[model samples]
Target: MAERHLEIEQKYDAAADFVLPELDGLPGVASAGEPEVHELHASYFDTADLRLAAHGITLRRRRGGTDAGWHLKMPAGTDSKQEMRAPLGRPLVVPARLAGLVAAYTRGAELRPVATLETRRTVVRLLAADGAELAEVADDLVTGCGPDAEPERWREIEVELKGGTPELLKAAGKRLRKVGAKKGKSSSKLGRLLGEAVVPAQAAAARAAARSRIAAATSNGKGPGITTGEVVLAYLAEQVEAIATYDPKARLEEEDAVHKMRVAVRRTRSALRSYRPVLDAERTVPLGPELRWLAAVLGEVRDLEVLRMRFAEAPAFVVEDLEKREKAAYRRMNASLREPRYFKLLDELDRLILDPPLAGAADRKARKELPLLVTRAWDRMAKDYASIKSADDPDVARHETRKAAKRARYAAELAVPVLGVAAKRVVKDAKRIQEVLGGYQDGVIAMEHLGTAAKRTKVPAEAFALGVLYGKEQCEALAARDHLSTTWSQTLGPSF
Candidate 1:
């Protein structure tokens, strides 16, 4: 089993000759507990190229402390990390589960012991008036060993919060400074031993600069060696990042996180479909179904959230029914997030961004290639719009039209940064079509939910209210249908 916590702490470099200062008189410290000492031994692991360390991530197996275990630390904030812990296993071996969790960064790279630190730590606990422990301070003497380096030694002070506020940390820093202790030179023992920052700022800045140039090339429609493939892949890469960025937020049930992740998945899938000329469709086709699988699972929870908020005025019994379904939907969402298939999907996406499969057309200038792609998507939407206008089952046709509109909108969006105002105009019109159709689809879903609620509760007042809501939705759908022709005509002319 494993557990996670936020490790919030500060560190300061201490001279070998410095004496320990009295911390009891600080802000919330009423008295201090007896000083306890421990000899801690930790071995750090990383890829041969130091991939994990370069990203400010650490994997270690440590012993001889109250928190001894296998720990993985990922950068969370300026001075914070999300630490995941697992029980100690056989010596010098990392736990399989812990290794699997970081596969996103390590990929298939080997995790070998890179460095070892042996620390003789003296710890003091600061207390509050109520005897509640606020924080713990550790003064340490360390010996570091690397692959082929001679043993090195250092001394430092670490102030880690147990139940303390930021104010307590600030107060402690003041006292430590007065006694000759200064801020720690490095964030981690491993970082200090390696003599490098956890994240290499210069390397990160250079990568960011390169990405900016690629973005500029597409946006300005000018850059030597810029190709149609570069623009599409850059947009796709951004969406891939969005999916990963929102993954944890959605798992933690943050507001609208799931919706944003789902949108990223849809946008990526649409980009792949719309830019088939620039990319080899055969290789990219498999990705579409995987993206759709994720989106459908996310939609189950998102749709419920929308309904619960939309019908907040519904009768108590109806609201209760909705709540039950919402809980089940959330369970489904959480289960899907934990599945191995989802992780595989993420890995595949990362691989796609790293090395995309491109065809001959990809090397051509985006200025000439992208507009033609946009026109194809628009023409598909036009056909779907005409079909909806003439179909007997207008509801079914409207759904298809909605999907087509979305594709056209995404296509225009990809072009807007390059094609300028003309593409922006298409984006606006395409969006209106999508929203109008979205409302109709929502109404369809709402009626089904209302019918289910009416059956479950069998309450006459609730049933009557459901009928009224259904009628309103019917009217809205009809109104949207009436506006479709004008909306389509506004921008789908030969010029666009």
Candidate 2:
């Protein structure tokens, strides 16, 4: 249901300025391009606080343009944005996905039209050396209208650089800046047209409520309440950002990008668990199960990713060495890596993410309110680690320790984006903890399997080999535990 477009549009102050003859050959009209430009008018919709702009997003309804409908401009790093348009229906309502995206920033707020503007435009083309048009440049006479009868007109240039880097933009912009073609004062066309009406109202209230909610969440259950509202909102915020950030990475098929984004899905569910007291678990209850389903759906390629990493690091000396006692030890790992169970796991992960049971969080944006589940979660993170550390069974302790690491990692991640450095230190500590526990757990499982297989085969040579591997694992586990102690002391201090 997600869609995107790489939009390229340029604005200009005057038609003359747009028509400078700087080339031996040009595109579109060849000699003199079509001067025809539609008179455009658009109504900008934003929260009273202009939440959309704060998130580097813009949404508006426009008429008189060739493509008239609702347009949502998503941030495309600096100086650019990906514009997504949804056609207006009989009801003229916003698309569900588009609205959901905005809801993350707006929170529990309303979207309304604050201002309108009209544009008189002429369009021209940028051409390659062969007279092929590379991109278009639009010249606009912006007339600020509505909310005031005495409307004002201004001139500016718009360029949608085709197949050009921001660096080329820099070069061209420098040339234009010499002639006062500096960066557009407003972030978007709607902003320039209706700047006076929207910005101030959106700034003051700011992140006030979000900050309070986050703080309360951090202190929840110890007298101060951490609302499920806080945790859920925080989780939603991160997921929305993940969706936005990973869009390009998904398009490019970056290694582990999909899986990384999928982890955000788990993190959201984990927050739900860690902060269970805040939400109507009955209402939000089904979400955990659904999250599990989705996680499975996203697991396919991710499992492959894990295997690839494992195989890359798995030493040849550790596998299939018949003359060496470690031969049987290595063979089992290699055979397990190639098993169909691996494929089954991958398939399961994919189905869940693509089609989650989203019943728990139904159209959550409107006329819906939930309490905070914050304090208990933070407290749980601390207690959970302690419980893991104190587990009687060493194997179970290792697994629980990993679980605790994940909890801490999730907490640190949510905070890092909002609180910055202090949160980052927590993430680093948690990651070190995860590494220690994970290695020990992996070694334990591997050693146990090889030991069982060797005993079943009744091969003294295989048993001896497995015993040696088992000894190595025992040593490694102890080392990991010792390393974890040092890391925990250094980063988390004695209190941890």
Provide the overall lDDT of each model, using Cα atoms, as 2-decimal numbers: 0.81, 0.55
For candidate 2, write residues 294-360 as lDDT tens digits: 4664554454444334333233433432224323333342233234443343233222232322333
Residue-level lDDT of model 1, residues 1-496, one tens digit each, is 3688888889999989989888898778899999999999999999887877876788999999899999998777877887888898876778876776566556567799999999999999999999999999999999999767889899999998889889999999889999999888888888888874345633333334436867777557465456787778767777876786676556556699889999999999999999988888777899899999999999988888898887888887767767888789977876677677777787777667666788888998877787899888988988988897589997888899899999999998887666778888888888999998897788778878777766765667778988888788778867776777777667653244
Best by lDDT: 1
State the TM-score for model 1.
Answer: 0.72
User: Which candidate wins on TM-score?
Assistant: 1
Candidate 2 whole-model C-alpha lDDT, 0 to 1? 0.55
For model 1 the local lDDT of residue 30 reads 95
Off by over 4 Å in 2: 7-36, 54-56, 64-66, 130-132, 146-150, 178-182, 200-396, 406-430, 436-496
